[model samples]
Every structure is written in C-alpha cells, then in structure tokens.
Target: MASGKEKPLHSLIAGSTAGAVEAFVTYPAEFVKTRSQFGGQKESPFTIIRSTLASKGITGLYSGCTALVVGNAVKAGVRFVSYDHFKSMLADQQGKVSAPRSLLAGLGAGVMEAVFAVTPSETIKTKLIDDAKRPNPQYRGLVHGTISIVRKEGIRGIYRGLFPVVMRQGANSSVRFTTYTTLKQFVQGNARPGQTIPSSVTFGIGAIAGLVTVYTTMPLDVIKTRMQSLEARQLYRNSFHCAYRIFTEEGLFRFWAGTTPRLARLVMSGGIVFTIYEKIIAVIGGRE
Candidate 1:
C-alpha cells in the first residue's frame, strides 16, 4: 500500500501506463483527426480513412504513433503529478478540494504537459501525418523528422505552436479534471459510504468529461494544429493570427473541422485512460 507521501509517484506511474494504452488504441483516429484539421481538406473521417488505406496501406494510420505514445506517457505522468501537488496545495482547512481549485490544478498540469511534452510531440506527430499524405515525403520517420526539424528550424521549430498548445491543453485539462471530479463527487454523494462506483460508470463519466473538454477548447486546438503543421515561418504568424485566418478563410464551423474523429478518439481515450488509471491506483492502494 502506498502512503500519502508516495501517492504522487503512484499517480505518475499509473498515469503513464494509462496514457500508453490510450495512445495505442486511439492513434489511428488521431491521425485521421489531425489530417481533417489541416485547413484545406474537406474529407469526412471515413473518406480520409479509405483514401489513406488505399494509398499508404494500413501503416498510414499509425504514422506518428511512436512519438505520440512516448509523449503521452510523459504528458500524463507530469499532468497527474502536477495536478496532485497543486490540488494538495489548494485544499481547504477541511481537506476538501473545490471545483475551482481542481480547475486550477488541472490548468497547472496542462501548462506543464504543454511545455515539456505536448508541444514537441504534437509538432512531430503533425509533421509526420502531413508528410505521410505527400507524394515525396521530406522526413523518413520519427527520428528523421525530429532531426530534420532541428536541422532546418532549430529547437524552436519543434515547439511550433507552443502558445496555442498551452492554451488548448490548459483549457482541456481544466475542464476535464474539473468536470470529472464534479461528476465523481456527485455520484459518490448519492451512493452509500464506502460503496465503490463501478468501472463502467467511471468510464462513462470520463467520456462525458472528454466531450466537454473538446467542445470548450476546440477552436484553440484547430489553431494549434494549423500553426504546428506548417513551416516555422509560414502563413500564420501566431495563434491569434492563425485563428483570424481560419475564421476568415474557412468560416466559423471550420474550427471544429475534425470533430467527428476527434470526438471518437477523445471519448474512448478518456474513458480508457481514467478507468485504467483509477483501477491501477486502487490496486496500488494509493489515494485517488
């Protein structure tokens, strides 16, 4: 059993394991989702999947899985660690965490993940996905792509959409954790003391939280994708610039371009990650 002092470490371990599982299961959906948000493409998720499979075979769906899996592991670990730390700091005299405090902790977690993990990972993943659709691809694979970006655009290139990514992630984690915690609390409040909530119920709650997250911050996500997918000094100057351009050129609805595939990926990934994470934490006798 993990003591209070070791709870944070357990969260890190469990979160990483959950992230790896989520990434592996949802990466194909992620590939198509990213492609759909690439600005000019109007293909439905099914059409994109069909064309990609026809042209690049089944392998195309997993174009950037390596970078994404590694990144998500680290991202989830840092997120849970930072969130737990922040939550403890924000707890009231009664040791209760309010919704606003939970939101703040999640915001902190998101910033940490964005700076340390998501930026580089998403940049590499987006580039690889874009390259896969090209006739003559520039980067060979993950390693080559990383090296190419560094050689051409330097370290900054790898963190292409840092600001928007931070914004999106900040809002994502804030809404997700806040909503999930609120829902979980509401469920527990109605249940008998010491009664366990089923894993299926927890998973359902997580899916709802993920849906809230996607809707609340999708515009920023679109801008982040657009900014990261381009060359270092390309069409869009910054997040605001990218948002302006997308709104003007593509119309308002374009901000949610990849909604279908994104919803599928997030709903399933969120449910699986949270359910597995909670189960692992329980097995380790750690505080949730």
Candidate 2:
C-alpha cells in the first residue's frame, strides 16, 4: 500500500502506465468521437462504426491509435507530475489542499501538459485520422506522418489548435482534478488519514469527474478537434474564427457533436486511469 507521500518520479511512471492503458482500451470510442466530430453531428456513432468496419475492417477504428497511446502516456505523466508539484506547493502545512488550490494546480498541470505533449500529439493523431479517411491516404505511421506534417507545414502544422488545446486541457484538468479531489475527500470522510479508498469507490469518483469534465468542456473539445484537423486552415482562419464559424454556420449544438462516444470513452477512461494509477502508485509505495 502507498504511504501517501508521492514523488514526481512515481507520479510520472504511474500516470504514464495508467494513461497508456486507458488510451489503448478506450481508443475505439475515441476514434468514433473524432469521426463524428470531423464528419458531422447528424451522423450517429453506430452509422460511423458500421461504415468504418465495412470499408476498412477492424483496423479502421484504430487509425491514430499509436499517436494517441504514446501522446496520452506522456500527457498523463506531465499532468500528474505537474499537478502533484503544484498541489504540494499549494498545500497547507499539514499537506492538505483546499478545493480552490486544487483547481489552480490542475489548471497549471493541464496547461503544462497541453504545451509539452498534447498539442503535437493530438495534431498528429487528428491529421492521421483525417488522412486515413481520404481516398488516397498519404502518411504511413506515426513517424512518417509527423515528419510529413513538419516538412509540409513546418513545425506549426504539428502544433495546430495550440490555443484551443491549451484552453480545453486547462479547463479539463481544472474541473476533473477539483471534482475528483473534493469527492474523494467526501467519500473518505471519517476514515483514517492516508487510508486508501476501495478500488470501486475510486473508479466511481473518477467516472463522475470525467462526466462533469466532458460536459463542461465539450465545446472547447469540438473546436479543438476541428482546428487540429488537416483542412482546418483552409476551412477556418483561427481559433476565434473556427469557433465563430462552428457557432454561426453549424449551430450551437454543433459544438457538442461528438459527445456520446467521447462520454463513453471518458467514463471508461476515468475509471481505468484512476484505478490503474492508484494501483500502480500503491505498488510503488507512493500515494497522495
């Protein structure tokens, strides 16, 4: 069991492992969500899944899995490490953080991860998925796709939607961590300090957090996804333009086009990520 004292290295390792596992496990739903966002809101996930399977087989659902898996691992590592560091800094003498402090820490962590890991990775993943849908797909894999993007559009190509990504991630982590921390504290009431909650309880709390985060940030997510796609520049000028176009042309509900699959993915992702992270931390003798 963990001793409730977490180090940065422990957070990195545990978070990375948990993120990679979660990404791989829940990737199909992610694929569906992206396709739903890219194609149109009116198209149901079932129709997309059926069409993808019919046209490309099972592998069709995993077009950008490699990029996402790797990116999610690094992103999660950065998130956990930065969040822990910020939380520690903001913690009181007894090592307890208020909800407000936790939210701030999560925002900091989210921004860090967005700049370092998420932007490029998500850009590559979105591009790859977009490319695969083309009649003549260009890039082969993660390395080739990344190099091609950089060569064609320079480094900025891979950093598409940087602003929206940062915003989405910032809000995502802020809401998710704050919710998780507050709920975990509530659930652990009357328990001894540092006593690990049951796996089921942790999973439930994480799911709730993810649920809240998805709704709270779904618009930003939609905008980010659209902006990161290969043809975003041709379609829209900038992040503001993109948001305006989506709102004025596509309607307000368009901003939440891919909520279902995203919700499913996050629900499972939240449970799996927290459960695995805590388990790994416990085995490694670190917890917070």
Candidate 3:
C-alpha cells in the first residue's frame, strides 16, 4: 500500500496513464467533434472521418494528437492530484467528503487543470486541426506549430478560449466526479463488508457520468472549440460575441453540432479512464 505521503504521487502516475490511454484511443472521435463544431454540422461523423482519411491518410485522424495526448496526461494528473488535495481538505472527521464538497473539489481540480494544461494544449490542437484542413497548412509539426503560434500571438494565442474552456471543464469535472462518487458509494453500500466494487460497475458509473456531463456542457464545448480556432480572430471578438454569433447566425442547435462524436468519445473515454485509473490505484494501494 502506498503511504499517505505517496498517495497523491501515485494518483498522479495513475491519472496520467489513464489520460494518455484515453486520449490516444479516442482522439479520432475528438477530431470529428472539433471539426463538426468549427465547420458546422453538415457532415456526419462517419463522413468526416472517411473524408479526412481519404484526403490525408491515417495521420489526418491523428493530426493534433500530440498536443492532446500530452495535454490530457498533464491535465488528468493535475486534476487527480488537486482533486485529492481539495477533497481531503473538505473531508469530514471520518475522512468522507460530502456530495457538495466533492463537487467543489472537482471544480477546483478542473479549473486548475484548465489553467495549467488544457487551455494551451487545446489551443494548439485546435489550430493544428484547423490548419490541416487548409489548402496550404502553416504548421509543420507539433513542436514547430507550437513555436509558430507562440511567436505569432504570444501567450494569448496559446491560451485562446480560456474562459469557455474553464467553464466547460469546471462543469464537466464537477458533474462527472460528483455523479461518479455518488454512484460508487451507492454500489459500495450494496456490497458486503470489505468488498470492493467491480471494475465493470465502475466503468458503467463513469460512462453515465460522462453522458450527463456531455449534454450539460456541450454548448460550452462548442464555444470553446470555435474560440480556439485559427480564424477566431476574424470570426468574432470574444467568447460572448462568439456565442452570440453562434446563436444568431448558426441557430441554437448549432451548439450541439458535434454531440454524436463527443458522446462517443466521452463514453469510451470515461469508461477507459476510470477503469485504468482504478486499476493503477489498486496496484499502488491507494483509495479511490
């Protein structure tokens, strides 16, 4: 068993492993989701994936995966570490966190990850995906592309869509973590003394949490993607304007343009991430 001193570090390792696996496995769905949001919902997810593969080969499906993989790893690590920290702080005398406190802790984790990891990496990933769609792509690769964006627009460019990203992530984690915790507790309650919940049950709980989170936060997800897009400078002024334009110009339904792909990705991602995270935590003998 990991010592109390080692628990947070073990969580970091477990969360990073889970996040990287989820990102790599589900990135194609993410690509389609972003494209649908940015380009509108004209094409089906299948069509988008097929077209991208036909035009750009397998690499097209993985265009901005580098940024996402790295970002997700760091983001998940930070999220788990901060979540544990905040949850511990908010825990009662019995070391149990209430639902509201769990939600708040998750919010804090999400905001911390968004500020430190998600914004910059997602900006780069969105720009790379947008660039790949152009007739003449500007970015050469992940490292070079990041350098180009930073040189051209500085920190602001890398941190584009910060507001929407923060909102989306905060909502996402709060809902997801709270739902998961509640469900896990329910399952644990059903079990006999000292019996741990099964991995399958944990996966199902995570999947349900993901579904709840996606519908609640889809609008913010669309807004965040658009705000981070390369043409965002020319398209709108800020996050508010961007949302306004999306509402007035593209219609209300446009906010859910990529729901299908996002749904697919997040469902699998939730299951995979939670399963792996728990497995690794078990290996390190850390509490969930």
Candidate 4:
C-alpha cells in the first residue's frame, strides 16, 4: 500500500501525465478558442480550422503547443497535489470528504496553479496564437516570444492578466472537482458491491462537470483571454475595465466568444485528465 507521505507525489505525477495527454489531444481546439477570444467576427470552428490550415498550414493549429504542454502539465500537478492535500485536511474521521470541502479544495488548487503555472505560460501561448495571424509576426515562436516579452515589457508582462486568470481558474477547478466528485460518488453509491465503475463512466461524468465549469466561468475566461492577448497593455486598465468595455462595445454574446471551441476542448480535456488521474492513482494504490 502507498504510504501517506507518498500520496501527494503520486497525485502530482498522475495529474501531470493526464494533463500532457489532454493538451496534445485538444490543442487544435485550444488554438481556435484563443483566436476567437482575440476579438474578431464570430467564426465557426470549421472556418477557423480551414483558415488556419490555408494560411499557416497544420502548424498554425499548434502555434504554442510547447508552452501549453509544459504549462498544463505543471498546472495539473499543482492542482492535484494541492487538491488532495486540502481534501485530506477536510476529511472527517470516517475519511469522507463533503461536497463543500471538495469545492474549497479545488478553489485552493486553482489559485495555486494560476499563480505558479497558468499566468506566464498562457500569456506566452496567447501571444504565439495571436502571431499566427500576422503577416509578419513579431514573435517567431514560444522561445522568442518569451524572450521578447521579458525584454520589452519586463516580468510583469508575462503575467498581464493575473487577476482574471486566477478568478477563471479558481472557478474552473471549484466547479469541476465539486461536480465531478459528487457525480462519481453518486455512481459508485449505486454500483453493485465489488463492481468497479468503468473508466468510460468516469469520462462521461468529467465531461458533464466540464460543461458546468465552462458555462459558469465563461465571462471571466473571455476577459482573461482579451487582457492577455492584447499587444497594448494600456487598452484596458484592469480586469473589471476590460469586462466593462467588452460588454459595452461588443454586447453579451462577446462574453462567450469562444464557447464552441472552448466547450469542445474542455469537455474532452476534463474527461481525459480525470480518467487518467483516477486510473494512475488506482494503479499506485493512492487514495482516490
């Protein structure tokens, strides 16, 4: 059996592996979502894919994949480690974690991930994705973009939309873990004794949880995307100002600019991440 001290490390490893797989599989959808959030006429996912292929070839669909893969892996590691730690702290003598406790644990995980991994990596990824459309892109790729941002705008530039990212990510994890844990419990509670719930069922539960997360936190996501994607930092004063401008100038639909692509990416990502995480934890004899 896995020792208590080793459980957190196992969670981190499992979560990173799951995240890397999710990033690779959903990168194309992420590419389109980033482009859509950068403020243009609403384009269908197919149109975005076609245009990206025609203009920049298949490479365009994975413009900042390097940063995404690494960032997501780190983010997932932090999330799972922090979440498991918090959940354990919240557990009762019976070792049962309540829904509210799970939600709070997820919130803590999200904030940790945003501060350590999401902000800089996402900023770089957004820059690279934005550059894919330029006739003469300023940043050649991920490495060049990172260097340029630091040289021109300083370290602060790398975390431009930290507030909104934190809000979005916090809400994302809170809703995801709460809903997923609740659903999984419901499933397991109903299962026959000695019968394990299948991975496919876990994937479906995770997908539903992801949809809940996307809708609940989409406005914050839109704000974060715009703030991070802008070449000019002076465009909006802060997160509230950015949201106000978008709402005033672009209307309500703008808040959900990339819903389709985001929905597609997140639904699959959630399923893949949770399935792999649970499977690995089971394999390692870690507490679920």
Clashes of each: 0, 0, 0, 0
lDDT of 1: 0.87
Query: Which of 2 and 4 is the better model by lDDT?
Result: 2
TM, every model: 0.96, 0.96, 0.96, 0.95
Show the lowest summed lDDT stretch of 10 residues, model 2: 1-10
Worst 10 residues of 3 by lDDT: 1-10
User: In model 3, which regions exceed 4 Å deviation?
Assistant: 1-6
- As for lDDT, the candidate ahead, 3 or 4, is 3
lDDT of 3 by residue, 1-288 (tens): 111322788889999999999999999999999888885448888888899999999999999999999999999999889888888888778666778998998999999999999999999999999999888899988999999999999989999999999998999889888888778877777888888778888889989988988999999999999999988999989999999999999899999989999999998888888889888998877764
Ranking by lDDT: 2, 3, 1, 4
lDDT of 3: 0.89
lDDT of 2 by residue, 1-288 (tens): 122457889999999999999999999999989888883446898998998899889999999999999999999999999998898889888777789999999999999999999999999999999888888899998999999999999999989999999999999999999998888877777578867689998899899999999999999999999999988988989989998988888889988888999999998888899889888887887764
User: What does the lDDT read for residue 170 in candidate 1?
Assistant: 95
User: Which residue pairs of candidate 3 clash?
Assistant: none
Better of 1 and 2 by lDDT: 2
Q: Can you write out model 1's per-residue Cα lDDT over 1-288, one digit (the tens) per residue? A: 111332888899999999989998999989988999986658899999999999989998999899999999999888888887887898777655789998998999999999999999999999999888989888888999999989988999899999999999999999999988789878888988878889999999999998998888888888888898855367887778888888998899999988888898899988998899889998897784
Model 2 scores what on Cα lDDT? 0.89
Question: Model 1 Cα displacement at 144 (Å)?
Answer: 1.4
In model 1, what are the clashing residue pairs, if there are any? none
Candidate 4 segments whose C-alpha is farther than 4 A from its true place: 1-6
Q: What tens digits encode model 4's per-residue C-alpha lDDT throughout 4-79?
A: 3238788889989999999989999898888888876777778989998998899889999998999999999999
